[model samples]
Target: PEGSSLQACDEAARKLTEMILKEDGVASISTYVGESSPRFVLVIDPVQPRNNYAQLVVVAKDLKSRKNLEKKIKVLVEEQLPNVQSYSRSIPLGPPTPYPVMIRVSAPTDALAKEYAGKLKQVMLENKNVTMVRYDWMEKAPAVRVELDDDKLRQMGLTRKTVASALYAEISGYSISQYYEGDQAIDIVFRLEPKDHQSISDLGTMSIPTAKGAVQLNQVAYLSYENEDGMIWRRNLLPTITVNAGIADGVTGNDVTNQIMEASKEMRNKLPAGVTIEIGGPSEKSEDSLRSLLGPVPAMLVIMLILLMTMLKDVRKVIIVVCTAPLGIVGVILGLFLFNTPLGIMAEIGALALIGTIIRNSTVLVDQIDQHLAQGMPRLKAVTESVIVRFRPIMLTALTTVLGLIPMFPSDFWRGLAIAISCGLTVATLITLIVMPVIYCLIFNVGNEEK
Candidate 1:
């Protein structure tokens, strides 16, 4: 497909546009042949111009219609345009990758990398969940190679340069002179008309200009057809060929990537020196996002602990409050499960927000218990009265926060975060009101004596 002519890509793009335009819910479609559409919006990174590449942008009536049309178009492309390799996806919300599953195979030489890429593509195609398996380095394109004979060139009073120049001028073109208009100069190109040299045989009989006389090109050279690489991809100066694939319905990118890694163990072991393979795409992006999110967590926690220790002045109470934060994770898990939401980056952020709230509630109850103790109440009375006094405020605070998050539940981006905060806070507040008092009573030996 990479070696296809520009005309071929243009025809395919037009055909695809016609098919998609017939589908319901599609408002309009733009087709870009031999290149991608311009950067209409900020997120779209346009594809570079290539002889074989084409892109289509389809606009739908609404969000619901768009989702449905995406599925239908995918089916249509596969069933109707079997010969054209195609992929359909909406604009990505996160970092954009060419495919869901990308396996990068790098080697010292381009040929070695491409060879492994083909092998890797075969391995990926074996998985039932992996579809549209292909490599960036496509099949080679046909090329004409001219081999000149030095002995024949000398005998004919023509040099290799003269014959090559004549062949180039006939096949492509020769810039004979430049025409100047104002300060701009334009190339005056010249070449034989298409009717004169319509085939390769005509090239062999072309005449080469020389000082002595014009000589036939066939006496000095030979022409043959061979295949050469259409394109090459490199990463960090090393040739890297990435084998990318799409996942089937009801499967995650990570699941298929893991399967491919496990299946390719034998192939990996057989890799030659200076060759390496790595998993990329969504899995790689996810790991990077997680790392960036978690990098500052330890420092933040240390600062929070220092503040907690300074406030309570009691290691046991500080430990109790710190320990209460993680228990909220149970509620977070339950929240995601009950709401049918995946625990994504937004959800993790909501869980982190729960930590501060839990610590705040625990500190308030503990401080109130101390206040009662300072006012000459017995330890048991102090623990009991603190819970009784703070219970309404903590419960009301959680209820109000949960109600405030109701509007976010319907949004695809913030739904997970909303669920995590609402559910985790509700359960964590209960733990703080009930468990905080009990832990206080036990830690201070309050329950051993009623008086």
Candidate 2:
């Protein structure tokens, strides 16, 4: 993943680093450019580590910032990058987990840090599941300040550089060479005592030596608190104020997100016309995926009905098979409820799989009973006899299928499928035993004498 690049990769890396550091929640940022493409690495803080699983890496330049740069990057990478099957704005290269909201706040000075910490703590305590909130950039209170007025420095025949060097000498101290004692070596440096530079008022009164004489800092320059000046966090290319929240064990990411959305909505409305609020996280992806999986169900049903008509040919036989399908589905629903599992996309797909298998079994049983009656056996006798003969194979197939699926129950990928099929088959087998016979007798008078 490393090689020399024709383009100035170092320049790109430096610029990207500068851009990311300006944003909040980012603890540290690094970049690497190889023969294939550039890679970005970011360390971010969320409300909880469990809620933020993936390390988001993007190859395209658009993802480098909050601009819609994905499309442009896709085109460029495709044309320039060799053997590229695809390129993306961001790819999750780590383990998957629920998504987290990004919250940002800036307090450059130590006094502001205390104020900001207090407000953040109050907000976090109001929400039960918020376990952690970390600051991206922090500035401690200034222990000393050295100030030089340009006019006064010019009149005194001394430059600001002279004043700065004198202050640095007093603070950093002069380092002496290492001295050996036995097998150990130690170095010495001289500076003011800890108490001499501990307070703002103390720093203001400290004396600075110059060629003319020693001068107190308060006589020449004003001293006060100051912090690093820069953007701390950003969103959509603008400086942002934000924080992330994690859900409790029993609650869903969506549930926690909804609460945050509700809390922020009133505040968001009060903001000026240029400002806006957006809620994003893993819940959005979950909702979208589920919708995609369920959206095709109705269309699939119509196709299935058409196929059933063509295959079964008889309306009565088709109706019986269709009727039995619901019993299987009802069983699946009840099973999910009993197990306390959410009916996710995988579960819905499992139900679809069960439908096909159940229809096949029903057709086999119903067709056999119809053949027996058409051959002139008494209707009740035919029903009972058909069930007796077919019962072993029917039960055996259902049991074998259920047993085969049992191993998959523990896996996330196939557990839903296993549960749905096992429950559907069990219910359909029972309904076929009890309901099919009653339906046959009501529809066809095989046991009754001619009128």
Candidate 3:
């Protein structure tokens, strides 16, 4: 309710955690006092949090439970702490980040960015799908600000450097000098001894050097615990405020992003000319990954077209063979849907491989028909023979391939790939055996020559 300080933050976290743990499906609750990580496996470069930032991480037993648990938590929080601001989140699709929904507010100044970031944070919290609203850049940490008085330093017959070093030596110790115990040299470290350094208020009583004697630090320097947001974050040489939050269960990152975009659309018209808002975190990354995958598709299709035209030497024949590949894609999509799998990178790779297999089957049938035509067989007879002859091999190839990949079908990591390949091949094989010959005849005007 008040300013952010460590003690205040911890007390708030415990209270929030107490409220969240009461939910039926909640399995565990992790409370953060000023932006510390819940995970213990590893920590990269870390930043010291300044304000009374806190979080209540509520994890439920399962998906069905998680949604209900979160909804209950929201209701409890709303009923009890309506004055407090909070953000929520659902399961994220991409890799973990600082926040699932990070709204980056870039403006001319830290204050300006922070202002917009606060506004955006409220906008996000308004959406039921969003949660855990936080912005560290705007947090004014409780800290002592000490500035040396120039006149006081000169009157005390002390230099600013000496007084500054003395202050540092009192609190955070530094090397006085070094000593040697044999060939190895050891630098001597010094600071205010245990009793004198016990409290932050001791600084008022701490002494600094003067020409005549020692003077208390308060005589030479101004001291007070000023609330200041010390950390200044810059991106692209412009100040930025990152407002982050989590998503609610039964919701997706895309859904949250879409809601945010809709909610913030009016903000765009109201925003200053130089100011900008960028939605980031997992949602943005997911879109970028998807766009990257789709970006190369047109080029790949062009290359495929050129290769097919070069190899077949006939536009009509190449078109017929290439068209059979999509027969497999229908199965690919169907299999993914049935298995409740996302059409991710693994599925795309599987689809690419599936296309090759489909084209191979179509090529085999078409080649067989061409051979028959070269021998002067009737066009319809050629088509019948090609279908009959190629059916066994196409069926056998697909069946064997599907059987081989069936072992991988159950694994989550490989499930999409397995389903795409196995199902696509099976469907495409039938298309190649039963449909390709007809397409071939229609394309080349071969089967109806006599008719």
Candidate 4:
């Protein structure tokens, strides 16, 4: 179906439109024939125009309506239109992926690329978590290949260009000259009547005009029917095929991608020379985003260390504060588990912010202890008094921060960040109030110091 005519694709789209209109919550549908819709949203990457392709942009009433329509439309298309390939999904809130799982196979030639693409598709289909697995390039369509006989052409006093022009005029129209009327110019074309060149057999029998007179095409050439790729995808001019799939409910795309990767170890080992396979889609996008976000982390940590040293002026206290920073991981893990949130980029950001919060809390407590020691208080009293004095302020700071994040919990984008900060800060506060003081006393030999 990849090489289906525009009429066929249009009919399929019309039928699907009828089915979709009957569903609830569908407000309107804009249909684009012979191509994908124009880019209206940044997340949507439209495909190029092809005779066999049509796209529909469906609108729903609200968020709840959109969610319901997404599931219903997917089922409707899969069940009622088995012959047609279709993909239905809601516009993503973040980076867009054509499918949840996309595996790309690239090779030096199209045949080898398609061959391994099929193998990769089979591997994906074997996994229970993968569904609707398919590749971008569909089955080859029937085509005609013409091979001109050079010796016969020369004997007939014909050049390859003349023969090619004659064939083109017979099979499809060839513009000869222009005719103007009423300020408009129209090309005068020549082509055989539909009945005369409708079939491949007719093509071989078409006449070509030469200096000698008209000669049958088969007299100087060969015409054969063969299967050729309907569409070819390439990356850097090397043939590439992408096998895409959807994941089952309740499973993340990364989880299924990892599973498939593990299962295909043997397949990868057997891959032909010059062929390479890799995973793409959501996982790849997320990784790229995270890498960019984490690029400045080491610099930030170094800057924070410098600030802490300048403020506290002691390596012992700086070590105590820095060591306490990672203790918030316990809360991050526990919070995500308790709230059923994923440790996504937003949550990672919150964890990073939590580090600054933890350091601030610990620095205040340590600086308090330093102040008391400077005032001639015994080491034991300094450590004990620091914990007692910082307890109320630390707890209040964490409480207010957690309360402020309550509004963000309802948002899909900010929920992870909110949970990470709220939960990590709560735990980090305890480390500052309790753990930091204990570590400080231990490092300074408070118990053995002369009282």
Model 4 TM-score, 2 decimals: 0.89
Ranking by TM-score: 4, 1, 3, 2
Give one digit per residue, the lDDT tens place, for model 2 in 40-141: 233222222211111223333333353344444444445554332222323332224323433444333334433543454356557776544433333232
| Candidate 1 residue-wise lDDT, 56-167, digit = tens | 9999999998999889988887887777888888886556677889989999998888788888888898999986887777578977777899888777787767776777
- Each candidate: what lDDT? 0.85, 0.59, 0.76, 0.86
List model 3 lDDT by residue over 344-404, tens digit each.
6678779878877788777777788788989998888988998888788779888999999
lDDT score, candidate 4: 0.86
Model 3 residue 417 lDDT score: 86
Better-scoring candidate (lDDT), 3 or 4:
4
- Per-residue lDDT, model 1, residue 53, is 88
Task: Tell me how far the alpha carbon of residue 145 in candidate 4 is from the true structure, in angstroms, after superposition.
Answer: 2.0
> What lDDT is reached at residue 289 by model 3?
74
Best by lDDT: 4
In candidate 3, where is summed lDDT lowest over 10 consecutive residues? 38-47
**Model 1 lDDT at residue 60:** 97
How large is the C-alpha RMSD of every model relative to the true structure? 3.7, 17.2, 6.1, 3.4
Candidate 3, residue 116: lDDT: 86
TM-score for each of the candidates: 0.86, 0.47, 0.71, 0.89
- Report the Cα lDDT for candidate 1: 0.85
